[model samples]
Target: MSDLAALYSEIEQKTSTFCTTYSIACAQGCGTCCEHFMPDITASEARLVGAYLLFIKKDFSLIEKVRQSIGNQEGPCPLYRFDSPFHCSVYPARPLICRLFGACAYQGKNGFAVFRRCKYNEEKTMPEHIDFHSEVPVMQDYSYLLRSLDDQEGEVGFLPEKVASMLDQLQFLAVMLDMDDTNPDDTPNPMAS
Candidate 1:
Protein backbone atom coordinates (compact mmCIF):
# COMPACT_ATOMS: atom_id res chain seq x y z
CA MET A 1 0.00 0.00 0.00
CA SER A 2 2.83 2.34 0.83
CA ASP A 3 4.38 1.43 -2.49
CA LEU A 4 1.12 2.30 -4.24
CA ALA A 5 0.95 5.59 -2.38
CA ALA A 6 4.50 6.35 -3.39
CA LEU A 7 3.64 5.58 -6.99
CA TYR A 8 0.59 7.82 -6.85
CA SER A 9 2.71 10.60 -5.40
CA GLU A 10 5.26 10.18 -8.13
CA ILE A 11 2.50 10.26 -10.76
CA GLU A 12 1.01 13.37 -9.23
CA GLN A 13 4.33 15.19 -9.29
CA LYS A 14 5.06 14.18 -12.87
CA THR A 15 1.60 15.05 -14.16
CA SER A 16 1.59 18.36 -12.35
CA THR A 17 4.93 19.27 -13.85
CA PHE A 18 3.77 18.23 -17.29
CA CYS A 19 0.56 20.22 -17.01
CA THR A 20 2.43 23.25 -15.75
CA THR A 21 4.96 23.09 -18.54
CA TYR A 22 2.21 22.81 -21.14
CA SER A 23 -0.09 25.28 -19.36
CA ILE A 24 -2.76 22.59 -19.31
CA ALA A 25 -5.37 22.94 -16.64
CA CYS A 26 -9.01 22.19 -16.11
CA ALA A 27 -11.39 25.06 -16.19
CA GLN A 28 -11.87 26.26 -12.60
CA GLY A 29 -14.68 24.53 -10.68
CA CYS A 30 -15.51 22.46 -13.72
CA GLY A 31 -15.90 18.71 -13.34
CA THR A 32 -17.18 18.18 -16.85
CA CYS A 33 -15.00 15.12 -17.29
CA CYS A 34 -16.28 13.36 -14.18
CA GLU A 35 -19.80 14.31 -15.05
CA HIS A 36 -19.76 12.06 -18.09
CA PHE A 37 -16.99 9.56 -17.42
CA MET A 38 -16.43 6.58 -15.18
CA PRO A 39 -12.84 5.58 -14.60
CA ASP A 40 -11.64 2.00 -14.94
CA ILE A 41 -9.20 1.47 -12.08
CA THR A 42 -7.09 -1.33 -10.64
CA ALA A 43 -7.47 -3.12 -7.31
CA SER A 44 -4.69 -1.16 -5.62
CA GLU A 45 -6.23 2.15 -6.61
CA ALA A 46 -9.56 0.99 -5.22
CA ARG A 47 -7.89 -0.12 -1.99
CA LEU A 48 -6.32 3.26 -1.43
CA VAL A 49 -9.60 5.05 -2.10
CA GLY A 50 -11.57 2.64 0.08
CA ALA A 51 -9.12 3.04 2.95
CA TYR A 52 -9.20 6.80 2.63
CA LEU A 53 -12.99 6.81 2.69
CA LEU A 54 -13.45 4.21 5.44
CA PHE A 55 -10.76 5.50 7.81
CA ILE A 56 -10.03 9.06 6.81
CA LYS A 57 -13.24 10.66 5.57
CA LYS A 58 -15.50 8.30 7.53
CA ASP A 59 -18.18 8.61 4.87
CA PHE A 60 -20.39 5.55 4.81
CA SER A 61 -22.98 7.11 2.52
CA LEU A 62 -20.36 7.57 -0.16
CA ILE A 63 -19.39 3.95 0.28
CA GLU A 64 -23.01 3.05 -0.27
CA LYS A 65 -22.96 5.14 -3.42
CA VAL A 66 -20.01 3.15 -4.67
CA ARG A 67 -21.90 -0.06 -4.00
CA GLN A 68 -25.01 1.23 -5.68
CA SER A 69 -23.19 2.28 -8.79
CA ILE A 70 -21.94 -1.23 -9.52
CA GLY A 71 -22.37 -2.31 -13.17
CA ASN A 72 -22.78 1.29 -14.21
CA GLN A 73 -20.23 1.85 -16.97
CA GLU A 74 -21.75 5.02 -18.42
CA GLY A 75 -21.92 7.48 -15.61
CA PRO A 76 -21.20 10.58 -13.81
CA CYS A 77 -18.64 8.92 -11.54
CA PRO A 78 -19.87 8.01 -8.07
CA LEU A 79 -17.22 10.14 -6.36
CA TYR A 80 -18.21 13.22 -8.29
CA ARG A 81 -19.76 15.97 -6.22
CA PHE A 82 -21.59 18.40 -8.44
CA ASP A 83 -21.44 21.24 -5.96
CA SER A 84 -17.87 20.92 -4.76
CA PRO A 85 -14.94 22.90 -6.12
CA PHE A 86 -12.96 19.68 -5.93
CA HIS A 87 -15.64 17.50 -7.49
CA CYS A 88 -14.05 14.18 -6.70
CA SER A 89 -14.90 12.87 -3.25
CA VAL A 90 -11.63 10.96 -3.06
CA TYR A 91 -9.29 13.43 -4.69
CA PRO A 92 -6.26 12.48 -2.62
CA ALA A 93 -6.66 8.85 -3.62
CA ARG A 94 -8.11 9.27 -7.11
CA PRO A 95 -7.17 6.61 -9.67
CA LEU A 96 -4.24 6.89 -12.04
CA ILE A 97 -6.50 7.65 -15.00
CA CYS A 98 -8.06 10.47 -13.05
CA ARG A 99 -4.62 11.84 -12.23
CA LEU A 100 -3.41 11.61 -15.81
CA PHE A 101 -6.40 12.67 -17.90
CA GLY A 102 -6.02 16.09 -19.49
CA ALA A 103 -3.03 16.72 -17.23
CA CYS A 104 -0.42 14.62 -19.02
CA ALA A 105 0.46 13.61 -22.54
CA TYR A 106 -0.45 10.35 -24.24
CA GLN A 107 1.95 8.13 -26.17
CA GLY A 108 1.40 8.89 -29.83
CA LYS A 109 1.65 6.29 -32.60
CA ASN A 110 4.89 7.96 -33.69
CA GLY A 111 6.48 6.95 -30.37
CA PHE A 112 6.42 10.45 -28.94
CA ALA A 113 4.24 12.36 -26.49
CA VAL A 114 1.13 14.16 -27.68
CA PHE A 115 -1.40 16.30 -25.83
CA ARG A 116 -4.72 17.78 -26.88
CA ARG A 117 -6.96 20.16 -25.06
CA CYS A 118 -9.88 18.70 -23.20
CA LYS A 119 -13.16 19.47 -24.98
CA TYR A 120 -14.64 20.69 -21.71
CA ASN A 121 -12.00 23.36 -21.33
CA GLU A 122 -14.43 26.10 -22.28
CA GLU A 123 -12.21 28.70 -20.70
CA LYS A 124 -9.51 27.85 -23.22
CA THR A 125 -6.95 27.84 -20.44
CA MET A 126 -5.11 24.92 -22.08
CA PRO A 127 -3.46 24.58 -25.43
CA GLU A 128 -5.30 23.06 -28.39
CA HIS A 129 -2.59 20.50 -29.20
CA ILE A 130 1.07 19.77 -28.67
CA ASP A 131 3.53 17.46 -30.38
CA PHE A 132 6.55 16.70 -28.31
CA HIS A 133 9.81 15.08 -29.34
CA SER A 134 11.38 15.39 -25.90
CA GLU A 135 10.48 13.19 -22.96
CA VAL A 136 7.19 13.88 -21.24
CA PRO A 137 4.95 12.03 -18.81
CA VAL A 138 2.91 9.61 -20.88
CA MET A 139 -0.29 7.89 -19.73
CA GLN A 140 0.85 4.50 -20.93
CA ASP A 141 4.05 4.66 -18.87
CA TYR A 142 2.21 5.48 -15.64
CA SER A 143 -0.40 2.81 -16.37
CA TYR A 144 2.25 0.08 -16.55
CA LEU A 145 3.81 1.27 -13.30
CA LEU A 146 0.40 1.37 -11.62
CA ARG A 147 -0.55 -2.13 -12.76
CA SER A 148 2.78 -3.51 -11.49
CA LEU A 149 1.81 -2.35 -8.00
CA ASP A 150 -1.70 -3.81 -8.00
CA ASP A 151 -2.41 -7.15 -6.28
CA GLN A 152 -4.87 -7.90 -9.13
CA GLU A 153 -7.54 -9.53 -7.00
CA GLY A 154 -10.25 -7.32 -8.38
CA GLU A 155 -8.04 -6.55 -11.38
CA VAL A 156 -9.26 -3.57 -13.44
CA GLY A 157 -12.89 -2.53 -13.63
CA PHE A 158 -15.14 0.48 -13.45
CA LEU A 159 -14.59 2.73 -10.42
CA PRO A 160 -17.84 1.85 -8.67
CA GLU A 161 -17.62 -1.94 -8.68
CA LYS A 162 -13.91 -2.13 -7.94
CA VAL A 163 -14.08 0.37 -5.12
CA ALA A 164 -17.17 -1.26 -3.62
CA SER A 165 -15.42 -4.64 -3.67
CA MET A 166 -12.30 -3.24 -2.02
CA LEU A 167 -14.38 -1.36 0.56
CA ASP A 168 -16.06 -4.60 1.53
CA GLN A 169 -12.70 -6.35 1.90
CA LEU A 170 -11.37 -3.47 3.97
CA GLN A 171 -14.43 -3.41 6.22
CA PHE A 172 -14.16 -7.14 6.88
CA LEU A 173 -10.50 -6.74 7.75
CA ALA A 174 -11.35 -3.88 10.10
CA VAL A 175 -13.88 -6.07 11.90
CA MET A 176 -11.46 -8.98 12.13
CA LEU A 177 -8.81 -6.69 13.59
CA ASP A 178 -11.07 -6.31 16.64
CA MET A 179 -13.10 -3.12 16.54
CA ASP A 180 -13.55 -2.83 20.31
CA ASP A 181 -9.87 -3.07 21.29
CA THR A 182 -7.56 -1.77 18.54
CA ASN A 183 -9.61 0.63 16.51
CA PRO A 184 -8.02 0.71 13.09
CA ASP A 185 -10.41 3.47 12.18
CA ASP A 186 -8.38 5.86 14.30
CA THR A 187 -5.00 4.19 14.47
CA PRO A 188 -2.13 4.74 12.08
CA ASN A 189 -3.41 3.04 8.94
CA PRO A 190 -1.96 -0.26 7.86
CA MET A 191 -2.70 1.12 4.36
CA ALA A 192 -4.57 -2.14 3.79
CA SER A 193 -1.53 -3.70 2.23
Candidate 2:
Protein backbone atom coordinates (compact mmCIF):
# COMPACT_ATOMS: atom_id res chain seq x y z
CA MET A 1 0.00 0.00 0.00
CA SER A 2 2.87 2.32 0.75
CA ASP A 3 4.16 1.49 -2.68
CA LEU A 4 0.88 2.59 -4.21
CA ALA A 5 0.86 5.73 -2.11
CA ALA A 6 4.33 6.56 -3.32
CA LEU A 7 3.43 5.75 -6.89
CA TYR A 8 0.32 7.90 -6.68
CA SER A 9 2.33 10.75 -5.26
CA GLU A 10 4.81 10.48 -8.05
CA ILE A 11 2.01 10.35 -10.61
CA GLU A 12 0.35 13.40 -9.09
CA GLN A 13 3.54 15.37 -9.20
CA LYS A 14 4.41 14.33 -12.72
CA THR A 15 0.96 14.87 -14.14
CA SER A 16 0.63 18.21 -12.42
CA THR A 17 3.91 19.30 -13.84
CA PHE A 18 3.03 18.05 -17.28
CA CYS A 19 -0.38 19.68 -17.32
CA THR A 20 0.97 22.91 -15.99
CA THR A 21 3.82 22.94 -18.43
CA TYR A 22 1.38 22.43 -21.26
CA SER A 23 -1.20 24.86 -19.86
CA ILE A 24 -3.80 22.10 -19.89
CA ALA A 25 -6.63 22.31 -17.38
CA CYS A 26 -10.07 20.98 -16.79
CA ALA A 27 -13.14 23.15 -16.43
CA GLN A 28 -13.81 24.23 -12.88
CA GLY A 29 -16.70 22.45 -11.11
CA CYS A 30 -17.49 20.41 -14.18
CA GLY A 31 -17.62 16.64 -13.74
CA THR A 32 -19.11 15.66 -17.07
CA CYS A 33 -16.35 13.13 -17.57
CA CYS A 34 -17.18 11.05 -14.50
CA GLU A 35 -20.88 11.58 -15.16
CA HIS A 36 -20.87 9.24 -18.13
CA PHE A 37 -17.54 7.48 -17.87
CA MET A 38 -16.81 4.19 -16.15
CA PRO A 39 -13.17 3.48 -15.48
CA ASP A 40 -11.62 0.02 -15.63
CA ILE A 41 -9.46 -0.44 -12.56
CA THR A 42 -7.00 -2.99 -11.24
CA ALA A 43 -7.64 -4.99 -8.07
CA SER A 44 -5.04 -3.00 -6.19
CA GLU A 45 -6.88 0.22 -7.07
CA ALA A 46 -10.15 -1.35 -5.94
CA ARG A 47 -8.66 -2.37 -2.61
CA LEU A 48 -7.44 1.15 -1.94
CA VAL A 49 -10.84 2.63 -2.78
CA GLY A 50 -12.65 -0.02 -0.72
CA ALA A 51 -10.43 0.48 2.29
CA TYR A 52 -10.85 4.23 2.05
CA LEU A 53 -14.62 3.94 1.86
CA LEU A 54 -14.88 1.49 4.74
CA PHE A 55 -12.22 2.73 7.13
CA ILE A 56 -11.63 6.35 6.19
CA LYS A 57 -14.89 7.81 4.90
CA LYS A 58 -16.96 5.18 6.75
CA ASP A 59 -19.54 5.68 4.04
CA PHE A 60 -21.54 2.48 3.90
CA SER A 61 -24.12 4.11 1.66
CA LEU A 62 -21.44 4.69 -0.96
CA ILE A 63 -20.38 1.10 -0.55
CA GLU A 64 -24.00 0.06 -1.13
CA LYS A 65 -24.08 2.28 -4.21
CA VAL A 66 -21.05 0.51 -5.60
CA ARG A 67 -22.57 -2.87 -4.77
CA GLN A 68 -25.73 -1.95 -6.62
CA SER A 69 -23.77 -0.82 -9.65
CA ILE A 70 -22.11 -4.14 -10.40
CA GLY A 71 -22.01 -5.07 -14.11
CA ASN A 72 -22.89 -1.54 -15.09
CA GLN A 73 -20.41 -0.82 -17.86
CA GLU A 74 -22.03 2.27 -19.34
CA GLY A 75 -23.19 4.43 -16.49
CA PRO A 76 -21.35 6.96 -14.40
CA CYS A 77 -18.85 5.79 -11.84
CA PRO A 78 -20.38 4.75 -8.51
CA LEU A 79 -18.03 7.03 -6.64
CA TYR A 80 -19.35 10.12 -8.38
CA ARG A 81 -21.30 12.42 -6.10
CA PHE A 82 -23.55 14.74 -8.05
CA ASP A 83 -24.17 16.98 -5.05
CA SER A 84 -20.67 17.13 -3.67
CA PRO A 85 -18.26 19.93 -4.42
CA PHE A 86 -15.48 17.45 -4.97
CA HIS A 87 -17.76 15.34 -7.20
CA CYS A 88 -15.92 12.07 -6.67
CA SER A 89 -16.71 10.50 -3.31
CA VAL A 90 -13.47 8.57 -3.36
CA TYR A 91 -11.37 11.22 -5.09
CA PRO A 92 -8.13 10.64 -3.26
CA ALA A 93 -8.39 6.90 -3.72
CA ARG A 94 -9.57 7.01 -7.34
CA PRO A 95 -7.84 4.67 -9.82
CA LEU A 96 -4.93 5.55 -12.06
CA ILE A 97 -7.06 6.09 -15.16
CA CYS A 98 -9.13 8.65 -13.30
CA ARG A 99 -6.06 10.59 -12.29
CA LEU A 100 -4.67 10.58 -15.78
CA PHE A 101 -7.89 11.28 -17.68
CA GLY A 102 -7.25 14.92 -18.53
CA ALA A 103 -3.79 15.44 -17.13
CA CYS A 104 -1.37 13.22 -18.99
CA ALA A 105 -0.19 12.46 -22.51
CA TYR A 106 -0.43 9.32 -24.62
CA GLN A 107 2.16 7.72 -26.85
CA GLY A 108 1.22 8.54 -30.40
CA LYS A 109 1.76 6.48 -33.55
CA ASN A 110 4.51 8.91 -34.46
CA GLY A 111 6.42 7.88 -31.35
CA PHE A 112 5.81 11.12 -29.51
CA ALA A 113 3.63 12.10 -26.58
CA VAL A 114 0.30 13.67 -27.51
CA PHE A 115 -2.39 15.39 -25.47
CA ARG A 116 -5.77 16.53 -26.61
CA ARG A 117 -8.74 18.18 -25.05
CA CYS A 118 -11.07 15.74 -23.29
CA LYS A 119 -14.32 15.10 -25.14
CA TYR A 120 -16.21 16.46 -22.16
CA ASN A 121 -14.25 19.67 -22.39
CA GLU A 122 -17.07 21.64 -23.95
CA GLU A 123 -15.77 24.68 -22.14
CA LYS A 124 -12.53 24.15 -24.05
CA THR A 125 -10.29 25.34 -21.30
CA MET A 126 -7.55 23.01 -22.49
CA PRO A 127 -5.53 23.17 -25.64
CA GLU A 128 -7.19 21.50 -28.62
CA HIS A 129 -4.09 19.40 -29.26
CA ILE A 130 -0.43 19.32 -28.38
CA ASP A 131 2.41 17.12 -29.54
CA PHE A 132 5.39 16.62 -27.34
CA HIS A 133 8.74 15.86 -28.92
CA SER A 134 10.54 15.70 -25.61
CA GLU A 135 9.70 13.14 -22.95
CA VAL A 136 6.42 13.65 -21.16
CA PRO A 137 4.27 11.77 -18.68
CA VAL A 138 2.82 9.29 -21.13
CA MET A 139 -0.21 7.30 -20.08
CA GLN A 140 1.44 4.00 -20.97
CA ASP A 141 4.33 4.83 -18.67
CA TYR A 142 1.96 5.38 -15.76
CA SER A 143 0.03 2.29 -16.72
CA TYR A 144 3.18 0.30 -16.21
CA LEU A 145 3.83 2.04 -12.90
CA LEU A 146 0.35 1.18 -11.69
CA ARG A 147 0.74 -2.42 -12.85
CA SER A 148 4.04 -2.78 -11.07
CA LEU A 149 2.23 -1.90 -7.85
CA ASP A 150 -0.69 -4.23 -8.58
CA ASP A 151 -0.61 -7.72 -7.11
CA GLN A 152 -2.91 -9.30 -9.69
CA GLU A 153 -0.81 -8.71 -12.82
CA GLY A 154 -3.04 -5.71 -13.59
CA GLU A 155 -6.26 -7.53 -14.31
CA VAL A 156 -8.89 -4.79 -14.71
CA GLY A 157 -12.65 -4.70 -14.39
CA PHE A 158 -15.17 -1.88 -14.54
CA LEU A 159 -14.96 0.31 -11.46
CA PRO A 160 -18.25 -0.68 -9.85
CA GLU A 161 -17.72 -4.40 -10.20
CA LYS A 162 -14.14 -4.28 -9.05
CA VAL A 163 -14.79 -2.08 -6.03
CA ALA A 164 -17.90 -4.04 -5.10
CA SER A 165 -15.98 -7.28 -5.27
CA MET A 166 -13.17 -5.80 -3.27
CA LEU A 167 -15.56 -4.55 -0.60
CA ASP A 168 -17.02 -8.02 -0.19
CA GLN A 169 -13.59 -9.64 0.08
CA LEU A 170 -12.24 -6.96 2.40
CA GLN A 171 -15.28 -7.24 4.61
CA PHE A 172 -14.83 -10.97 4.95
CA LEU A 173 -11.19 -10.49 5.84
CA ALA A 174 -11.92 -7.69 8.28
CA VAL A 175 -14.24 -9.87 10.27
CA MET A 176 -12.13 -13.03 10.14
CA LEU A 177 -8.91 -11.16 10.70
CA ASP A 178 -10.39 -9.17 13.60
CA MET A 179 -9.41 -5.78 12.24
CA ASP A 180 -11.89 -3.77 14.26
CA ASP A 181 -9.39 -2.61 16.83
CA THR A 182 -6.77 -1.46 14.38
CA ASN A 183 -6.61 2.13 13.31
CA PRO A 184 -7.17 2.77 9.64
CA ASP A 185 -3.54 3.74 9.23
CA ASP A 186 -2.43 0.62 11.06
CA THR A 187 -4.64 -1.83 9.21
CA PRO A 188 -2.93 -4.48 7.12
CA ASN A 189 -3.03 -3.71 3.42
CA PRO A 190 -5.40 -6.07 1.67
CA MET A 191 -3.66 -5.18 -1.60
CA ALA A 192 -0.33 -6.49 -0.37
CA SER A 193 0.63 -9.95 -1.50
Candidate 3:
Protein backbone atom coordinates (compact mmCIF):
# COMPACT_ATOMS: atom_id res chain seq x y z
CA MET A 1 0.00 0.00 0.00
CA SER A 2 2.88 2.34 0.75
CA ASP A 3 4.43 1.59 -2.60
CA LEU A 4 1.14 2.35 -4.29
CA ALA A 5 0.82 5.59 -2.37
CA ALA A 6 4.35 6.57 -3.35
CA LEU A 7 3.64 5.76 -6.99
CA TYR A 8 0.59 8.01 -6.88
CA SER A 9 2.67 10.77 -5.36
CA GLU A 10 5.36 10.42 -8.02
CA ILE A 11 2.88 10.57 -10.88
CA GLU A 12 1.01 13.36 -9.19
CA GLN A 13 4.19 15.40 -9.21
CA LYS A 14 4.79 14.58 -12.85
CA THR A 15 1.25 15.54 -13.76
CA SER A 16 1.45 18.72 -11.76
CA THR A 17 4.66 19.64 -13.53
CA PHE A 18 2.96 18.99 -16.82
CA CYS A 19 -0.03 21.13 -15.96
CA THR A 20 2.24 23.89 -14.75
CA THR A 21 4.34 23.79 -17.89
CA TYR A 22 1.27 23.96 -20.07
CA SER A 23 -0.82 26.14 -17.77
CA ILE A 24 -3.51 23.48 -17.67
CA ALA A 25 -6.01 23.71 -14.84
CA CYS A 26 -6.83 20.14 -13.99
CA ALA A 27 -7.74 19.43 -10.41
CA GLN A 28 -9.93 17.31 -8.25
CA GLY A 29 -13.58 18.46 -8.33
CA CYS A 30 -12.70 19.19 -11.94
CA GLY A 31 -14.07 15.82 -13.06
CA THR A 32 -13.40 16.57 -16.70
CA CYS A 33 -11.76 13.30 -17.74
CA CYS A 34 -13.82 11.10 -15.48
CA GLU A 35 -16.72 10.35 -17.79
CA HIS A 36 -14.93 8.41 -20.51
CA PHE A 37 -13.13 5.15 -20.95
CA MET A 38 -9.39 4.95 -20.36
CA PRO A 39 -8.13 2.60 -23.03
CA ASP A 40 -4.42 2.33 -22.32
CA ILE A 41 -3.54 1.09 -18.85
CA THR A 42 -0.52 -1.12 -18.18
CA ALA A 43 -0.81 -4.42 -16.35
CA SER A 44 0.83 -2.86 -13.32
CA GLU A 45 -1.73 -0.08 -13.22
CA ALA A 46 -4.65 -2.44 -13.63
CA ARG A 47 -3.42 -4.41 -10.68
CA LEU A 48 -3.14 -1.33 -8.51
CA VAL A 49 -6.63 -0.30 -9.40
CA GLY A 50 -7.88 -3.76 -8.56
CA ALA A 51 -6.11 -3.69 -5.24
CA TYR A 52 -7.67 -0.36 -4.42
CA LEU A 53 -11.09 -1.74 -5.17
CA LEU A 54 -10.51 -4.88 -3.14
CA PHE A 55 -9.03 -2.95 -0.27
CA ILE A 56 -12.12 -0.77 -0.21
CA LYS A 57 -14.22 -3.94 -0.40
CA LYS A 58 -15.83 -2.76 -3.57
CA ASP A 59 -14.56 -5.70 -5.59
CA PHE A 60 -17.89 -7.39 -6.13
CA SER A 61 -19.63 -4.12 -6.90
CA LEU A 62 -16.87 -3.13 -9.29
CA ILE A 63 -16.99 -6.47 -11.03
CA GLU A 64 -20.73 -6.33 -11.41
CA LYS A 65 -20.67 -2.73 -12.53
CA VAL A 66 -18.03 -3.48 -15.14
CA ARG A 67 -19.95 -6.51 -16.28
CA GLN A 68 -23.08 -4.51 -16.69
CA SER A 69 -21.30 -1.70 -18.47
CA ILE A 70 -19.67 -4.07 -20.94
CA GLY A 71 -22.78 -5.86 -22.05
CA ASN A 72 -22.04 -5.33 -25.71
CA GLN A 73 -18.77 -3.52 -25.24
CA GLU A 74 -15.45 -4.90 -24.00
CA GLY A 75 -14.13 -4.56 -20.47
CA PRO A 76 -10.70 -5.54 -19.29
CA CYS A 77 -11.10 -2.63 -16.89
CA PRO A 78 -12.01 -3.79 -13.43
CA LEU A 79 -11.53 -0.33 -12.00
CA TYR A 80 -14.05 1.15 -14.35
CA ARG A 81 -16.40 1.95 -11.47
CA PHE A 82 -18.96 4.67 -11.13
CA ASP A 83 -19.00 7.70 -8.85
CA SER A 84 -20.98 10.83 -8.23
CA PRO A 85 -20.16 14.20 -9.81
CA PHE A 86 -18.34 12.35 -12.62
CA HIS A 87 -15.27 10.71 -11.12
CA CYS A 88 -13.75 7.27 -10.89
CA SER A 89 -14.09 5.59 -7.53
CA VAL A 90 -10.73 3.90 -7.81
CA TYR A 91 -8.99 7.04 -9.01
CA PRO A 92 -6.14 6.97 -6.51
CA ALA A 93 -4.75 3.69 -7.79
CA ARG A 94 -5.60 4.22 -11.43
CA PRO A 95 -2.95 3.29 -14.01
CA LEU A 96 -0.07 5.45 -15.17
CA ILE A 97 -1.69 5.46 -18.59
CA CYS A 98 -4.64 7.41 -17.23
CA ARG A 99 -2.22 9.79 -15.56
CA LEU A 100 -0.39 10.35 -18.84
CA PHE A 101 -3.55 11.08 -20.73
CA GLY A 102 -4.86 14.52 -21.86
CA ALA A 103 -1.44 15.73 -23.08
CA CYS A 104 -0.22 12.40 -24.49
CA ALA A 105 0.01 11.82 -28.22
CA TYR A 106 1.59 9.67 -30.92
CA GLN A 107 3.19 10.73 -34.19
CA GLY A 108 3.92 8.66 -37.23
CA LYS A 109 7.13 8.91 -39.23
CA ASN A 110 5.06 10.42 -42.01
CA GLY A 111 4.37 13.43 -39.80
CA PHE A 112 0.84 12.54 -38.89
CA ALA A 113 -0.11 14.26 -35.64
CA VAL A 114 -2.45 12.31 -33.41
CA PHE A 115 -4.10 13.86 -30.39
CA ARG A 116 -5.72 12.09 -27.49
CA ARG A 117 -8.36 14.34 -25.97
CA CYS A 118 -10.12 13.59 -22.73
CA LYS A 119 -13.85 12.94 -23.00
CA TYR A 120 -14.39 15.81 -20.64
CA ASN A 121 -13.09 18.23 -23.26
CA GLU A 122 -14.27 16.42 -26.34
CA GLU A 123 -17.39 18.35 -27.27
CA LYS A 124 -16.87 21.32 -24.99
CA THR A 125 -14.86 23.71 -27.08
CA MET A 126 -12.02 25.52 -25.41
CA PRO A 127 -12.70 29.03 -24.26
CA GLU A 128 -12.54 31.74 -26.94
CA HIS A 129 -9.44 33.28 -25.34
CA ILE A 130 -7.21 30.21 -25.51
CA ASP A 131 -4.97 29.04 -28.34
CA PHE A 132 -4.77 25.29 -27.86
CA HIS A 133 -2.36 24.58 -30.68
CA SER A 134 0.34 26.97 -29.51
CA GLU A 135 -0.24 27.11 -25.77
CA VAL A 136 -0.43 23.47 -24.75
CA PRO A 137 2.34 20.91 -24.91
CA VAL A 138 1.71 17.80 -26.96
CA MET A 139 1.19 14.53 -25.11
CA GLN A 140 3.98 12.67 -26.93
CA ASP A 141 6.70 13.67 -24.53
CA TYR A 142 4.80 12.51 -21.46
CA SER A 143 4.40 9.10 -23.06
CA TYR A 144 8.17 8.71 -23.28
CA LEU A 145 8.37 9.23 -19.52
CA LEU A 146 5.70 6.56 -19.01
CA ARG A 147 7.51 4.11 -21.24
CA SER A 148 10.44 4.19 -18.84
CA LEU A 149 8.14 3.10 -15.96
CA ASP A 150 7.71 -0.47 -17.07
CA ASP A 151 10.12 -3.44 -17.19
CA GLN A 152 8.01 -5.37 -19.69
CA GLU A 153 8.81 -6.68 -23.07
CA GLY A 154 7.40 -4.55 -25.93
CA GLU A 155 5.20 -1.48 -25.84
CA VAL A 156 2.69 -1.55 -22.98
CA GLY A 157 -0.87 -1.70 -24.18
CA PHE A 158 -4.20 -1.91 -22.38
CA LEU A 159 -5.44 -5.43 -21.75
CA PRO A 160 -7.96 -5.27 -18.94
CA GLU A 161 -8.84 -8.95 -19.01
CA LYS A 162 -5.24 -9.99 -18.65
CA VAL A 163 -5.21 -7.86 -15.52
CA ALA A 164 -8.89 -8.17 -14.63
CA SER A 165 -8.62 -11.36 -12.56
CA MET A 166 -5.94 -12.88 -10.36
CA LEU A 167 -3.27 -11.27 -12.52
CA ASP A 168 -4.18 -7.83 -11.16
CA GLN A 169 -3.65 -9.13 -7.63
CA LEU A 170 -0.19 -10.27 -8.65
CA GLN A 171 0.67 -6.81 -9.88
CA PHE A 172 -0.24 -5.42 -6.48
CA LEU A 173 2.25 -7.82 -4.90
CA ALA A 174 4.81 -6.88 -7.51
CA VAL A 175 4.48 -3.22 -6.59
CA MET A 176 5.05 -4.07 -2.93
CA LEU A 177 8.02 -6.30 -3.72
CA ASP A 178 9.52 -3.50 -5.76
CA MET A 179 9.40 -1.17 -2.79
CA ASP A 180 11.05 -3.76 -0.54
CA ASP A 181 13.95 -4.18 -2.98
CA THR A 182 14.83 -0.50 -3.28
CA ASN A 183 17.08 1.62 -1.05
CA PRO A 184 15.47 4.65 0.54
CA ASP A 185 16.12 7.11 -2.24
CA ASP A 186 14.12 10.33 -2.47
CA THR A 187 12.41 9.00 -5.56
CA PRO A 188 11.19 5.50 -4.67
CA ASN A 189 10.70 2.74 -7.22
CA PRO A 190 7.20 1.27 -6.96
CA MET A 191 7.97 -2.32 -7.93
CA ALA A 192 10.97 -4.64 -7.92
CA SER A 193 9.57 -7.28 -10.31
Best by lDDT: 2
Model 2 whole-model lDDT (C-alpha atoms): 0.85
**Model 2: residue 160 alpha-carbon error in angstroms:** 1.4
List the pairs of residues colliding in candidate 3: 76-160, 76-161, 103-139, 104-139, 105-139, 178-191, 178-192
Q: Which regions in candidate 3 have their CA more than 4 angstroms from the true location?
A: 1-8, 26-34, 67-83, 103-138, 141-159, 167-193
Per-residue lDDT for 64-167 in model 2, tens only? 88988888898788888899768989889988988899999999998889998999999899999998889889999988878877887878889888888888
Error of 3 at 33 (Å): 4.1
> Which parts of model 1 are misplaced by more than 4 Å?
180-193
TM-score list, all predictions: 0.89, 0.89, 0.54
RMSD of each: 4.9, 5.2, 9.6
Report how far off residue 118 is in candidate 1 (Å). Answer: 0.8
| lDDT (Cα atoms) of all candidates against the true structure | 0.84, 0.85, 0.49
Ranked by lDDT, the better of candidates 1 and 2 is: 2
Q: Write the per-residue lDDT of candidate 1 for residues 1-193, one digit (tens) a residue.
A: 8888898888888888888887888887888999889999998888888888888888877888888999889889989998879888988889889888889988989888899998888899899999999989988988888787777553688988888888778877786674422243455445544
Q: Residue by residue across 3-39, what tens digits does model 3's lDDT show?
A: 5456557667766765565444544455544444435
State the lDDT at 136 in candidate 2. Answer: 87
